[model samples]
Target: LAIAHQYVTQGGLDYAREILESALGPRKAKEILEKVQQTIRTTGFNLLENVDPKQIVNFIQKEHPQTIALLLAHMEPKNAAPIVSALPQELQVDVATRIATMESISPETLDQVEEVLVSQIKSLFGGDVSEIGGVKAVAEMLNSVDRGAEKNILGNLERENPELATEIKNLMFVFEDVLLLDDRSMQRVLKEIDTKDLSMALKGASEELQEKFFRNMSSRAAEMIREDMEFMGPIRLKDVEEVQQRIVDVIRRLEEDGEIIISGRGGDEDIVV
Candidate 1:
């Protein structure tokens, strides 16, 4: 056990697990193996996370979307988003769609992706076959990407697979994410959105989010929107959601156009002067 633990600490998790199984029996080995496996996975994630995204982009650019999706599914969203954004635009959509619809990746497929990474990245992938790449994965990755890449990918995805696109979009930055925008960005977004749409959208929002928008506006304008929302009274959930989506679309468009910056969500960190 001491020798195996040494091997594990040195990143020889598979070898250590095998040694443990042989010496300690499967039942006892399993407990140790599980811990070893978790360590291996964390090591694998950190190894990839530490790599330059451009190196990864150049290495995998020519690979099939399914291959790209499978590899990215193993990475943390922050690490994966830039690679997706750097991919050729068409591949971006294809990979995003594949990731949204993907359920599980076979061990063989994982090994193949690992082989590609090992050749170019000098990194190892160590983990069991597991569920990965569903709508949430795609959403999280997209959330971390620039609005332009995110919009282009989702736009193409909408035409190719509407239902999957809607599902992924639903999981992504919702109306509530507006609260994440800085005051300057919030004011810029408000300029693009109609007051009625904003009122309707805020109807379903939390008080905090409503106040976020209100504080960014003039006192008169903020009070007017509040009055508009109250007069509208008891709007349908579906209607509120629709208007919220429209407002969210406007925010996405403005960001894509470089009119505003949404910081701390991922992607490039902007230093505002």
Candidate 2:
């Protein structure tokens, strides 16, 4: 008895649970088995460390709300938001509510959730994947969606769960995120933008962002844009958004190619090489 107790304690609760399962029967040991397996998968290996967010979306769609919520909780919000937005309307609120309110889930429950994903992931490709949602993940996802879908998801989230909404918004980068770029990167982006598109994009921009753009340009160019904006009268919101999205696309491409760094998306570090 002493030796068994020592082995259980030394091996950890998971190992102990596996031993007990043999006597408890499969039905009674199901929950314990789940915890043991989940711990092994997550801690023993990076099974889903950097898997695409879309893959996560596929998995969560078929899961129970509680299970989905648990998985999302573990993921970055950026990755989770798109999944939430893409969900069938009826499930959105329920799953989101669970995310906002979920707390202190047992290892057994988490194991059960991870088990479902692990099995599906194994069947799909038979290898380790990346972790899911985070603030950055949600931000990146929002950056890709249409404005209307973005707005609706955030609106519903704000109503159903204000706290999570605020957190996600802070993480996201919209047209206004341009202001966050350092001067050099900002200038690089400016060089690629057409005057007309810039004018249209700024039609609905806040004075602060406009000032940021002006501050980054030659005085003459600033004066010219100011003049253009003043006369650009009554532009459609959709047009402004389209041009803004275009500018955002340019910035994203530049960032992807290592041409420029956008602050707060984790690229602020000084690379020695």
Candidate 3:
């Protein structure tokens, strides 16, 4: 029992002392347990404080599912949730089950796991690991650039990594995403964006999105826009994309300023307000 208590305490389980005290009724043991757990929590979270969730997921994906489960069990829910969700679907169930069934991890084992994670994070920054690229990062980057640039970059990324490019495109909020916006938010964004930019942006937009925009406008205004788009024939794809990106930038700014709400990508809640 003394060895068990020592293991529990060293493992940073605050409840270890509680269990010990229940049987032994020792106050000093409880105090020591509290301190140990506090130290572990502080140190562990600090190690991951600057690490991105994607990097963590990538690092752990190479580990055993049980090991991944154990590591996540020690992490904050906020940090762990996305990593878990981002994991391959088949592994998610296995890892989640492992975490649920996990009882106790030896302190030495925990330390090893932490050391591996920390080292992996260092490797990522040291360029030992492939740079972390994700749909969210790509979409956010494209949102800031001209359409032509966005297309060129995405085209290159696609040729090199088709899967990644596809994922990024799925995450990106195109002119089509405007159709998903609430009417009020759409109106709010439309009010802020220049009509010319909107017209050019709509040139490449889906018909559904174009009609949604028309429906939101007065009939006369909608007719004027349609006429303008028709008369502005043979526009370059680059110019269309550039103007579209400009409109997207406006919507992004509106969303950022809290004037409009942009729904999240990949069927998720907005990660950032």
Candidate 4:
């Protein structure tokens, strides 16, 4: 009650948890947490290898059996669904089928394990959410009611980066773009976007996003963009916008199934295909 009151008064859960971790759980939770911390300290950075796997394994063995089983089954899935979620449809099908076959678990047990796992996941995710910047930050951009549903997990990490926010605004292509061309025509158009345009685009993109674009583009086209960027003279945004649009249109036509992002001269220069 006092901790809850303090949290209400202070407007945060951190303080409350800190007080409790320090004040309560001396025999069980506190001792366990302290021992874990001490182990990590003794092991230093290389401690991952030295750390006993049974700490986790034992936790499962000694805890309520139902909670133990659920924790084992889900593990990282409790928070990293976005990264694992996009496994090829075949893999998704297989995993989903296997997971579905497990005996049903009690809701109360599931909830108990979930509360702790969710907290751990938030801490794990929060580190990523805090360190990433530029285009690499797309995880947080997605909306998820819970950690498991977050589609843009990468964007959450991006919340700290102004540059990443801009890159995300740049890569917003859609899947319905296949209607843009037949396969043969798409190949031809893909060849037309020179390295110059890509390099220009890269100037505004995150390294990961830039690599995705380059991988999708033809080698010749990528090289051409490079040449263009090299030979291209510095010019006004008006000229750049015109060229950028043409390049993006070509990329869109080539991809056939996705949008090509083109950076325009206007303040809203980021165009999504």
Ranking by TM-score: 1, 2, 3, 4
Clashing residue pairs in candidate 3, if any? none
Q: Assess every candidate by TM-score.
A: 0.68, 0.44, 0.42, 0.25
Extract clashing residue pairs from model 1. Answer: none
Model 4 residue 115 lDDT score:
62
Residue 71 of model 4 has an lDDT of 36
lDDT of 3 by residue, 1-273 (tens): 445446675653555766667776787666655455545444554465467988888877888997776666555544565676667766654564455445545555555665666665552111111112234543554444333344455566667667766656655676667876878887887788788887888888889889889888889989989988999888889999878777777776676465776554332233453
Q: Candidate 1 lDDT, tens digit per residue, 1-273?
A: 456567788767677777777889989887776665555654674677787899889878877878778778878987899898899898898888888788856556666666666766667764554687789999999888876788898888889888988888777868888877888898888888888898998999999999999999999999999999999979899999999889888887787677777666554555456
Each candidate's root-mean-square deviation in Å?
A: 5.2, 13.9, 15.8, 16.1
Error of 1 at 141 (Å): 2.7
lDDT of 2 by residue, 1-273 (tens): 343344355796666666667777666566554444454445422434466657767766887887766665565455555566677766765665565555555545545555556666762211122333344555555555444455666678888778888766655657989987898998999999999899888889999999888888999998998899888779888888879988888887787577887665532344454
lDDT of each: 0.80, 0.66, 0.63, 0.39
Report the Cα lDDT for candidate 3: 0.63
TM-score of 4: 0.25
Model 1 TM-score (2 dp): 0.68
lDDT at position 112, candidate 2? 54
Evaluated against the true structure, the overall lDDT of model 1 is: 0.80
Scored against the true structure, residue 249 in model 3 reaches a CA lDDT of 72
User: How should the candidates be ordered by lDDT, best one leading?
Assistant: 1, 2, 3, 4
* Highest lDDT scorer: 1
